[model samples]
Target: MKKWALFLLMFLLFILLACNDEETNEHVSSDQEEHEKPEVRTTPSESSKPKTKPLPEMTWEHLVNQEEGKLTANLDVDEKMSDQLVETLEKEITALTDETNDPEQIYRGAVDLLASSYYQTYFEKASTYDPDFEEPYLPDPEIEKKEGKKASPKKAFILLDASSSMLLRVNGKIKMDIAKNAVQRFGEVIGQDSDLSLLVYGHLGSESSEDKQLSCEGIEEVYEMSPYDEETFQASLNSFESKGWTPLAGAIKEAANMSRDFTEDVTVYVVSDGVETCGGDPVAAAEAFTKDSKERKVHIIGFHVDETAENELKKVSDAGNGTYYPADNEEELQDTIQKRWLPSLADLAWAHTKAPGPWEVLGKLEELEKHTNKLTEVRQLETERLNTVYRLIRDHDLLSSEAREDLKALLDERDDEIRTLIKNLTDEKKEDINKQADDIKNRVSEWRDRMYELRDEERDHS
Candidate 1:
């Protein structure tokens, strides 16, 4: 019985100790939940990197207007480095040929030199800024500019020199008659819906010394600036006779004066038979006429002009950014007007995009074409350098014959990648330009429509 009681006492003590141990474990677990943590393995991609090292990143500053803040960028391109390019290309090719005869290595090394990034120190994007290759100092393609919103209209201006030279006969008809006929036909086509004007100079006084001052000063606008009307235009053409001194420069100056205020483009056609007889700088006048306007052309047609006259007229045309056509006879004059001049005028009017004015109509297109030139140059230069390296390896008998084919295939692959890049970039530029153009057009159309409605409302009130 004593043994049994001892056993029960021991068992109760053990049970109490077990309960204390369980409570202690529960307390430790609660503390652990409050303060302590468990460890876990993490992947490199999922973890945060150390800030000590930074990766290279590209910068972009989109175009900003009044709403968005402006941002500036470096406009100047690096100095030309063709010499450096040649030298470096040679060095790289030589190194590749000497170090390894593998055509793949040589090709890749050559390609690295041709990369756009590699040329950051040489040319910037300015190397391909101008498609014509004449204007090299143009602004960089990355220039930030607001979307253009100016509308362009096509207008035609005919400058008829009615000096006594027009009195001279050609073939069976008078030169004046031929010129008048051509002008009438041109009006029929160009003035179908477009604005047209006819200005006659040197038609009041005789083409003599005594009347030189009067003839030079006498300038008449036979037809006012408006759409062509057959009856009115014919009457205006017959308003004056051909008898006066040639005031070519004065006529150009006056035309320019008339065109200065017009937001629309004025294409001028000058019909003359001689140089400036009144001692005026026709060249300077032509230059100024085209300088301040949107897109003015001064096409000069010479009628039986001497070499000196042709030369002078050619200069004037060149200054005006136009072509000079020399017609020796009546048939030649008519043919020039019918075939070359008239067709060109109609085409010009047709080809002219009726959109917002002067935001570089061919901006992205020009850049795109120019970029191809640069890429072509890059490809040529890369291939040339690689070929040199390949030849060296071939001469030294260092590489297998199969290396040639392998290098060629690699070059082709690189070129394919470049082509893909060009396509993608082109698509992006085209989409952006088209969107901007469309936006401007729609906005302008709405504004003009609203303006017309308001004007009509005012008229009704009146």
Candidate 2:
């Protein structure tokens, strides 16, 4: 009986030892899996840290002067500058995470690694790898097309609203004061050849018609209003004052007329934060100024505007074929106007959309027909598009041959105008005119299918 008990104890000890060995093996396997890397990955050298050469340096003046459509590396010293910035941020992140290791630092180091990898790829893709580079990194080309036309440069007339509303505080500062600060930065963007005229409204009221007429050109002590010297433009921004009701519509119209002597590509920038208090339609005024057929497009910027007046400002901008930018407060307003408008104006200047008017020389009535032809083609396309919808709804049997004949005649007349214009255009203008003709052709093709459907529906009902 004693020998049998001893045998049982030995057997139990063996089972316990086997079980513990299995659990130990499992733990070791799990740890090994955690550290395993992809088959292709190799350990990097300690001394060989990923590196990227610095980007091309750009001065503030040079950067602002670059063509508007071109990508600009503006002085954006924000959260994404470099590895150092990432490193600092990582320390903060690690503190927030409560990790034993500095996870924030690790994250920043990873970001730096990514940026360096991209930079190396860019260099390799540019085929600029150094002779000593054993494993050169190359990035794919980002933008392929380089043939895009640049916008033309031009003189600018900036009109700022300095009415009572402009004095209303927003983002802890008055609106007019913010606008003035933005205007002061204009000196940095304006090219040597570009002339800038600053105009403000609602500073003073005049009962005299003469004063009112001059008010648009009113020099309320040009104390830095007109940039006589660089110093004046800078100092003037600090002294801008806001008072009274804004005669917005009149101010726009008058400013447009006064700045007529500027380059044909003149840009009129209207900065305001409210609806027109004076009795004039801002949209109508914008439309009229742009209607000259040779005038520059008017752009409107709404800064820190209330809900009451947002739509009105947008209307004025759209009517002028200009972009409307909304800036919530001072800093953003300054950045938006400078970073967006200045570049846009530069592009507009390069576009030279305002070719010297054909009417100026009074060369030939035939030449005038060329402009008329483009207008005709556009109208024909519009008419055909509209007719397609109209014909679908109408009873075909109700339509007479006379109505169809009248429409066909009108279309023929439009074609005749295009043909006549084509004979007179210079080769360059001919291509543009031809493109318009082609657009009309496409519209007509679409209308033909619609017309057939209308006829079939009419027949089925009959």
Compute each candidate's TM-score over C-alphas: 0.41, 0.38
lDDT of 1 by residue, 238-348 (tens): 788899899999999888888778887788889899989898899999998888753788889998788998999999999998879899986577555532111233333
Model 2: residue 9 alpha-carbon error in angstroms: 99
Best by TM-score: 1
Off by over 4 Å in 2: 1-152, 191-193, 205-228, 238-240, 339-462
Q: Predict model 1's lDDT versus the native.
A: 0.65
Evaluate residue 434 in candidate 2 and report its C-alpha lDDT on the 0 to 100 scale: 47
Clashes of each: 2, 11
Q: Which stretches of candidate 1 lie over 4 Å from their true place?
A: 1-153, 339-462
Report the C-alpha lDDT of model 2 over 1-462, residue by residue, as the tens digit: 999999999999999999999999999999998889457744457466455454323232232232321111221211133455434434433343233122223222222222111212222222221112111111111111132422323556677787767777886777877777676554435433356667777666543454444443433423322323557665655555665666778777876777555545666688888877666788888887777655466778898886668888889888876768888887667656443111233433432222223342233334544444443443344334323322421333222345444444543553454344334333334444444444444454444444455446657989
lDDT of 2 at 262: 56
